[model samples]
Target chain A: MPGEHPQTLTRSTVAVRSASAPAAPDAETLHEIHRQERASVTGAPVTAPLLPAERALLRSVEHAVLDERRLLTATELSALAALPDSAVMALASLAHQVRLTWCGPAVEVEGILSAKTGGCPEDCHFCSQSSRFDTTVKATPFLDTDEVLEAARQTAALGASEFCIVLAIRGPDERTLARILELVPLVHAETGLNVAVSAGILTKDQARRLAEGGVHRYNHNLETARSFFSEVVTTHSFQERVDTCQLVREEGMELCCGALLGMGESDEQRIELLSELQDLDPTEVPVNFLNPRPGTPLGDRAPVGAWEAVRWIALFRLALPGVILRYAGGREITLRDLQAIGMTAGINALIVGNYLTTLGRSSADDLQMLDDLRMPVAALTVAF
Target chain B: MTQLPAADSAPAFCTGCGQSSASCPGCGRDFDPPRYCSACGRWMGVTVTPSGWTARCKEHGEQHSA
Candidate 1:
């Protein structure tokens, strides 16, 4: 017996049998022997075998993803979400593998310019710009065309593939909308950057106009699950947001819709939100953690734990295997040191540089992180 | 007393230098207001109250207390 390690030999020893010895050990018999040996060494019971239901779920996931290479249904996704904590690492590994298969090693970088700030009439409890909240954010007039163009130039200079003009409003007034429509072509013509806009809820006509004006994507976050939305924003119904997203799709513009995690929502609600996103089939899903600006209603809520954030990102990737998953605001505060792990968990895009109302880590630092991970920043392309 | 123009109109000129005024006294460039921090040149998200102005910077919180 080449006893390099007694634990290592336990399995092969059982596999060998003479005619005089007992009949061939079954798979279960070998498993039990290994489990007993592990117990002996660790002085604790090994984890029990997967229950029938859990095994069925895992088999389904493997069959759907590995064998068939088809997207999992919402039911299958929920089953994955319902996996126990002990199985979370497996889930993350599957999600990371799925991300690599679909998105490869390219990390798309985008930047946002807060073109219009504060004085929003809506009452999103997490937003600092809401007029209903007494947060430190101050009202600023819509930036002039030159100012917006300068910001776009800076965005390009930072090597971001996309530049978004974000306005704080329930919806854009006619003048504000007209100004954005005019600026879109200028930005595209001048900077050679993909232009995106987040001008709050949109009418069908406005959506059509934006599509005609060279706007590539329209962003309007659902912000949370339908069941939990009312607790976060009372002024607007969730249906209206859904309607606007549908309108954006009808107008042939790519929809960039997502929700904020850690807003006092239950795990079921988080999975539900992902289900809704899967239904929406948005071109991009920007996952924002609740940063909880001081003076907002949710300011007192704690930041999401790093590992929990990773699990959330993993779940998002598993839920929407093909969509561009972006690391948006609150990443710096929530993930902190483990930001790179968040990328591995299923994030293929980043909101580089500053966010709308808060600052982000420097674009250089984000680029360096991508370099360290040996992931290239994606060039501007319509496929995303 | 001079009556201010409509809120949408061009901002008033600087009294000190006779040029168009920006919100930040230090930079004097036309930028969207509430302007950047005068001390550190970082963007300051300012809140105006009856007592005075309070500007918050991301790197340095509450840079200006008026």
Candidate 2:
């Protein structure tokens, strides 16, 4: 029995298409990762926690995700989503456990710069950059190379391993692409940090060029579910954004695809979006809440409730156990003092400094939160 | 003073320090940058970056979020 080989293992053209098979994990991946045990990051699970009326439903989810490490189906996720406020903390506890088991304790710190602010041609209802909306943001040309380099330097100083250069455009044109191509290597060379680009949609050639030129990841958000997309943006179809993400993956770069919540989409829609995100197979998912930019169509929308934020953060983690689930953009307004709750709720990464247009809480405060939680940040390059 | 082009031209009761009422406790506790100068009821032109924010009140000069 010990000497027998599987018949399926003899196939010539196996599932893996790589010219070479993947190498086994080194010490860093095997030993250094998952450094903590027993989900010590979050304190003791809730005492006599209020659970869903259907306790078995929660039990089944825990069994599938925790025991088997399988993704949750939309049906499983929605049942948890509809659970009363009483059962949320328990759900969060399970989500936190899934995160600890799957992702480990190392938190990825990143800083984002709005390289080209405002003046977008598209009409995204929740965006301040859209020219269709009479917003406070003014159209500005791209930042100079020096400015971009300085921002990257500052980002590096924060001990950030990743820096994203974001532009407020529908898609980067040839001229814009040239500037980005020049900057990606310069930023990486200078800061020793991976650079991600979020210059709207990308053509196949552009994605390949960026991939070949050393761009680490591409940021393109599906924003909402396909069914609810037309309500949020009139200019671009959700499929186009999906195609761009597909191209990024085809060209061999990590996809930093994300979603924006609280745009009045139904719970069913949110689950639908989660399932869709699973299908896309992103390495990172930046969970953004609608902060409701003024003058934009959705300016008056209310901020997502803090508890609701925590609940979804957990759901996203459970839904995509292997993703670098990040707390992005709206956490400042959405979670406020309860921000640290997200760390335990399955967020292994966050944008520490100011968001693109809105002001974020101090970097010192965020660093302190990580310190208090005893969570190890990946880099310790510079002290604030 | 140029009004904050923010959709809601009128600042909320929680806009800044003096504007706080019993109903809205203001941002001193919550720590949001002031969008309007409480002294003159003027919208503060705000530029927010990772470092912090600078809200410029036409008459009151500038307020930095240290």
Per-prediction DockQ comes to: 0.06, 0.29
Across A237-355, the per-residue lDDT of candidate 2 in tens digits comes to 99999999999999998899999999999999999999999999998999998888777899899999998899899899889988888899888889988899888888888898887
Worst 10 residues of 2 chain A by lDDT: A30-39
Clashing pairs in 2: none
Error of 1 at A53 (Å): 8.1
- Model 2: lDDT equals 0.78
For each candidate, the alpha-carbon lDDT, in order, equals 0.73, 0.78
DockQ of candidate 1? Answer: 0.06
Q: Candidate 1, residues A1-384: lDDT per residue as tens digits? A: 442333434444445322233333333443344344444344221233333334435545655665566766665665566555444555666777878877777888887888888989999999988989876576877877886787788788878878899999898779988999999999999999899999988888999999999899899898889999999999989999999999999999989998799889988788788878878988889999988776799989998877678878888987777788899989988888889887787888998876775667767788899999988888533222
Those runs of model 2 whose alpha carbons end farther than 4 Å from true positions after fitting are A1-48, A51-53, A379-384, B1-48, B53-66
Q: Which prediction has the highest TM-score against the true structure? A: 2
